[model samples]
Target: MTSEEPGDSSVVRRDRFSGGPARGFLSSLAADERIFEADLAVDRAHVVMLAERGIVDGETAGAILAALDDVEAAGHGALPDGEDVHEAVESAVIARVGPDGGRMHTARSRNDEVAACIRYRLREDALSVVEATLALREALAETAAAHVETTMPGYTHLQPAQPTTVAHHLLSYEAAVARDTARLLDAYGRINRSPLGAAAFAGTPFDVDRERTAELLGFEGVLGNSMDASSARDFLAETLSALATHAVTLSGLAEDLVVFSNRGYVDLSDDYSSTSSIMPQKKNPDTLELVRACAGDAVGDLAALLTTLKGLPRAYNRDLQRAHRHAFDAADVVGEATAVAAGAVRTATWNEGALAAAAGEGFSTATGVADLLAMAGVPFRTAHEIVAAAAPDVEDGDDPATVAAKLDAAAEGVLGENLRTHVNRDDLEAALDPARSAESRDSAGGPASPAVAAQLDAAADRIDADAEALTAGRDALAAAADRLETEVDRRV
Candidate 1:
């Protein structure tokens, strides 16, 4: 390889052009700065592995490792101009230790090195996302626990369908976010594998201990196939998919809160809400509206990533460099959105009287009455017809006695008997009461208070277990870094 003079361009361009406007078009330095620390760590691990495999002399490995330490101290911005951080770091290492520094690239190509660096940084990024999700879940669980018996209307097609508690509604979102956390943790399993020794699109000729480097980097294991290792980016797509799903869950929660605020069913904290510039009476859910928009952003990021990976052939491509920007953006947007949603839920106040007043509107307990008549041996369809016939008389302002008289007349017309023959007035009134209607649904996973209590307890347990898992992962990475640093010290 021909060496550029000291004052010449340090970039290793395959084309004839050394420096020009094209370099700016191809440069990834701005994005590459995100993974500079990971790049140095990969160098340290790779150098230690090389010396252990007898591929480089101890003195040369020590010199390269020490120079890498200097380059790290100088930071990514201090490096010479090049195509990317990998080239810039390599150029810095070579400048520090002369020709022997080139030995750092002996067993690995930029393809596998860049891949490893991405995985190294993304594992932590994914973990941070999971942590944010857990915080949101905890916030939701606490809010649900506080409102386990606060009766409200549950809707389908945005119309009242049944009576439910705020706890039941909030727990539903907690369930979805729990699944989102599981998807991310599952993706982490594959994302944490090492691709260090694949060397380019093929295995290196030198005998390299891929497992050793993987262990030193806290990866669960090495990616077995060299070509697949160099080309695979499915893990990134999988993570963004999980994030997009999570963002959708957040969007639903935000939409519901916005609707509740509109209906006077809930009041958001002033911190999360915004006032109109001219209309002094306006207090808008601007934070939630932005969170709802973030769902679209996450979905777009996932689409962009899948589209980028869709047509690329096996082995590394320049196109793969653009992939990280999508992953980083999706994770960041979703993470912040998750936190904002948690804050909104934690600080919002539910209007119990208003929610209860609306809960029984639209004859929301009609299903409960039908269920009660069916339990007394009336055919369900017959009972449904009897209630449907009397619904017009049971209007918004009618007294219970008048409503019952109308229902009795309807029942006699439908069944040729008074409605009291099979059920008493007390039973009928209990069935019609929205609070009793919600409380009557005591089956497992129902919107009843006891069911919601069980769900909230289960959510607490899941949050604790997931938090511990994240902590264990971080501890393992710290231990690996400690081991790597100790080994480097011995080699130096």
Candidate 2:
């Protein structure tokens, strides 16, 4: 029995972790690199607050800030090597400024650090998602304006239900995206609190200024409870849930685009659509399909975070670090997918004749027929069934008047002359025409030309308001990041 040499034992241990005797360390795949710039901005604010409050001497604080700046300047702050980002940062600071650089962790723990970084990232990414949503809203508004008078068939249960202007259909999506933007903005409000200075699962003994850190970090305030700050992932879940919802909404619109782009229906321009590689006759709506398919990844991202947090312990766990990859992936997926979807809407062409032909189908005017019978004192159900029976086997191109005339002659024998006083065949013919039916719906938000015009105008105003708000928010974030850099440079 002989003891192994120290070098030999080290070699064995390295192989155990590496699964090979002499392979180079596995290079990080960089699957889900976080928004490190935002995290560094937060770190800068935390250091500045420590100096201002005298928690660390001004020189040490200045050195740490300078090291951080240097790291950022060298290819945007390469993440330090450790179990996680907080450890990586602390290791870097210590390497740069001796033991005093380690003092920055005196009152903070990786638990609090992780929470703070996530919050900072959430706040930044939430605003970017909102901006992307505003772009989609703007494109929808533009589409609505271009097609305000282009009639199309609206459906219920995928069956033609009524005649609606194409603008009306487009504006429906704009309204949906506007609501999605508002939801992301609301989530940002909830994520705007600072989690720094919480220190693990409890308050620190040192007299640290959380409010000052919050101000420097551009957070509205310190999180109210230390324990909650360390353990809560609700903000991340909620923000990503909102993103997933937006993705789902866009996927639905994309599905509609895919269907509309097919030769079986509307003929979309070749610029916005692609042809199949192996089949010359096949024009594939690949862009819209991509938009539709990308939604599943966003949804999977939300589910992954939720599953990771489902049974976690009170304080932070190593598993929490693993959560970053999916959250980061989700934001990038959302941003890119949303931009693609918006571009498709802006550039795609619509065939107005196809839309008009779809609208003119007599089946789409059944509701108008029901309205007509109700106007003539027939009970609504009775009117519906009556029209349903007489509804010109439109498959055969039978006119509504011709169908109504046969029904009128039959009723002449069944209900005597009383039916003649209530029903006019000519009136029925006018009621069953889709163009007149669309024009008759002059109510607000209806498919009537004027109604759709007003909706387009309102959507434009909302798009501008949303875009301006997003711009103001982004400018503020940029300024905060700039201020941190400026302050760090000043001290250095």
What is the lDDT for 454 in model 1?
86
Winning model by TM-score:
1
- Scored against the true structure, residue 477 in model 2 reaches a CA lDDT of 69
Assess each prediction's global lDDT (C-alpha) against the native. Answer: 0.90, 0.74
Over the stretch 113-134, how does candidate 1's per-residue lDDT look in tens digits? Answer: 9999999998898899899999
| Candidate 2 lDDT for residue 284 | 80
Q: For each candidate, C-alpha RMSD in Å? A: 2.0, 5.0
Which whole-number lDDT from 0 to 100 does residue 124 have in model 1? Answer: 90
Any idea what lDDT model 1 has?
0.90
Candidate 1 backbone overlaps, count: 0
User: Against the true structure, what is each candidate's TM-score?
Assistant: 0.96, 0.89
